[model samples]
Target: MKRREFAALGLASLALPALAADAGFDGQVEAFLEALWRLDPDAAVAAGRFEFAPQITLPGSAQRDRQRAFLKHWLAEFENRSDATLSVSQRMDRAMLIAKINSDLWQLDTLREWAWNPANYNPAGPLDLLLNTDYAPLPERLKALKPRVAALPAFYRAAQASLAPNGGVTREHTELAIQQAPGVLGVLDDIAKRAAEAGQAATFKAPLAQARAAVNGYGAHLKRLLPSARRSFRIGAALYEAKFAHDIQSARTAKATYEIALQRREEVLAGMQAQAAALWPSVIGAEAPPADRFALIGRVIAKLSERHVARERFVDEIRAQIPQLEAWVRDHDLLNQDMSKPLAVRETPEYERGVAGASIEAPGPYRPQDKTYYNVTPLDELTPEQAESSLREYNHWILQILSIHEAIPGHYTQLVHANRVPGKVKALFGNGAMIEGWAVYGERMMIESGYGASPEMTLMWGKWHLRAVTNTLLDYSVHTGGMTEADALDLLMRQAFQTEREAREKWRRVQLTSVQLTSYFSGYSEIFVLREQLKAKSGPGGFDLKAFHEKFLGYGSAPVRLIAAEMIRS
Candidate 1:
């Protein structure tokens, strides 16, 4: 379904408590939340609540206007309420809801920077989420086809409308959209086949057929629109500046942020170098000569991968850890929610499409059945040399590091809690930096907690950290015109010590995505600083990792500054 519609559905789900609450003040507040939900299905779905309604799809301009109007009305209604009539908890929820709505409204106005990127354009991500969720039965999956399939034409029309006057897409973004298109079609075909076999003509068959035809038509239309897509509109530096301020809600300018991260990276590398010298005195004794950190890390990673089990066995190890991880969350009282459902680890076709090394598909608003997915993309069509390289990279220790990043107290765990957050604002305004930062932080936290006892594990974590550092530097340097792809490759190989294949793949990723590359290093630095500050303030008692994390996540995925404000207030 469309993102807006999913978001509205999420808002609606949060309102259900109002309809089910006890009478008087609490009931009235719940009633208000319920009303907001009915008004915004898109918000509702995003928050992991489902409402029974067809997805709403519209042209980009039209949707923007509609979203603005909805937020205006929603805000007004919230302001009209009297706090005297509500209980304390109800009042807090109301305040949070209003804050969230306002934040999202502001974000909507400033999110034009990403308009040209295909990552935000299409429906493949959501489609994968639906297919991966255990809660979605065959019938439910078929039912979902209506809104998703129906929305294709509008999505295409919006893409066409958003196209530049020149007849080509931005060279960097072209590959992602084109790659995702075939995958989307593949999904549509799968749904169509499933619908036909079920013999359910009304809900499933008709919509599926309509959607399949539309997708085909849309593909043809895209080719026609491709030439016009190439022209660059003058987004101007002012708009780009505004995107950092309003869209990201960040205090740091893009340049300032990049500088801070770069400085921190140099400091970290120096520290690591010192540690390497001390730990391996014979290899790189007291006053060690220049050594490639990337190569050292890569060698360690290669060894770890070899030591671990292959794919299926690796998946089993991850699955086995679920109960332990879940119990850890509960035993420590980390966050304010229950996430008992077992996450499934599977290989998906999208994995092969370069979605990421691994990812978690959180539950949608209308999906009552929630299943968290831990996905690993399998390598396809490898030459003998390539096959050996691929195997070396996917080795057991490396897989474990990946598993920690995608599952455990990482993305899956954090997302589950995030889904359960009561207000639409926190849910809808979720920041990429926070989401990704928390996952990277989780990986390090595990290692610090002694999870990285083996040499392979240490190497794997080090490799990931190097990637984060390299990604941040590349993102800024490439965009600001200070560095070329060759420079980036050299940095990755010489400084980060990545394998030739890994370095090349990362260079391509850096080209394909802009701001996203900065997320890892920026996020890690933000969290690292916050953790240090918290430790200093709390001193002996303040060093509770569980408490700090739960509180950090409770504020929703805002910029680190906002999170700091909330933490201080709490």
Candidate 2:
């Protein structure tokens, strides 16, 4: 059968109460994912492991042994399955699964964050997932959550055993985990309270207390381990590149991604300089401003950033724009509208704060029918100086483009379309590069299509796009080329034209993350190129932008190259 036919057939099978698949191809894939979910039960809940929600996957040697065995079994299974025997969709699913399994093994055996990062052991979030997703009734989910919460003390004890005395975790990670641990406990405490409100607190009482104690004790475990913590959180070059291959699921190498980003950065910088020069007569006057193009661009972008929302209004302003952004996209017919797909604009969950400005909480592949939260972190926690810096970073013009990136035609838009895909495997193990790339591409797509239709918006888009480029550059440089905090700040604040607070926070982020920072640029580059190819092929008036977008998003969040091949295939 053709790919689309297979996808439809596969999806129909998913709706069945019991797992059933085609005798050969779909059967193998279904069996593998089922086993994988049971093994990694916490990840399973979000990925539609409704049956397994009550169980938490404990971290430690026993868990790792199971993970190892699982990985080896899958690799052997893949070896026996010949591509020639399978349908196209089967081949694609098998390949993606193999890559994911390989990535998992590499992450476990090689990079080994579990050996280092104590935060990986946190079980509070798993229960939160069960509570929030609404795949079942509240009572049913609460029942599922109880066992997971009850299991936390044992989970953390196993996690504690997993940590090395003198290991790889940085002091920063330990400290952050210690701080965030409380917030996680708060989620559990709230769950117990909510259960009490519903007269089910007695069911949650013992586990909730034990879970809170486990979290606090975990915090203490980290505190004791702090002196032994090392600062080298960088996954190093070889592991970084290997992890990138699987996690990113793109053809680009780390070095190639870095080089492309450098070139893209220069391209964006040149565009911003021209934009700066155009506005120079009014903004900077008829005199030579700065010798360097980077500094000159920075000066002009700062002027555009001057019109920002007040610190207090930051969250409200962003919240207020969701409806307006939705309307604008509908007005423009940017993507096929899904009025039923619930997109919620809300405060970033307390347990998930202290990260990027905003992110999307999409339902897992198995549970497609759930609310998608567009989480924007409020600025109430920041100091005055910090708040000012952050506001400057997310100024009025940039905020709209950000809304486009995170909500309108970006993450929220792409994911709604993604959920419509019949291929669960594709959505379960989405290409990070493509997922992030689509959102970054969405920013430019809106500006180019005339949202604001002005130079300032164009300038802000350029500056924001530069962040994508800089992210990759920083990721590669920090891990491989030995970029320092001073270097990172200078690159982000000066050349990238980001605010001081933003630059400092980004420095912290790069250290915590690995090749993930590179996904935005790498995916965007491939996607933008693909769009150009489509546009060129269709020719000016013949090119249907809306059709191109739907086709692009229709493939779900697979690697851009895969989508490109399928969309433009003969």
Candidate 2 regions with alpha-carbon error over 4 angstroms: 1-23, 85-87, 284-288
Per-residue lDDT of candidate 2, residues 1-570 (tens digit): 001101111011112112333457777777887887788776777666679877666787988999999899988898778877664445556777788888888888887888777666656556677776667777887887777778878888998888777655777677767867877977887797778777898777777888888888888889988987985877688878888888787777889888888888878888888898888778878788887898788888887777899998887898888888888888988776676778787887777665576877776666566677778889998888888888888999888878888777777777767666655777777778888888888888888778988878888888899999999999899988788899999999988999998898889888767888989888999998888888888887988888778767766667887777766773
Candidate 2: how large is its RMSD?
Answer: 4.7
What's each prediction's TM-score?
0.76, 0.93
Model 1 stretches astray by more than 4 angstroms: 1-49, 71-115, 118-121, 124-144, 147-155, 201-210, 224-241, 246-251, 275-339, 349-352, 365-369, 381-395, 419-424, 454-456, 540-543, 554-559
RMSD of each: 5.8, 4.7
| Prediction-by-prediction clash tally | 38, 0
Cα lDDT over the full model 2: 0.77
Q: What lDDT does the true structure give each of the candidates?
A: 0.58, 0.77
Per-residue lDDT tens digits for candidate 1, residues 392-443, read 6555565566666677677776666555545434454456666677778887
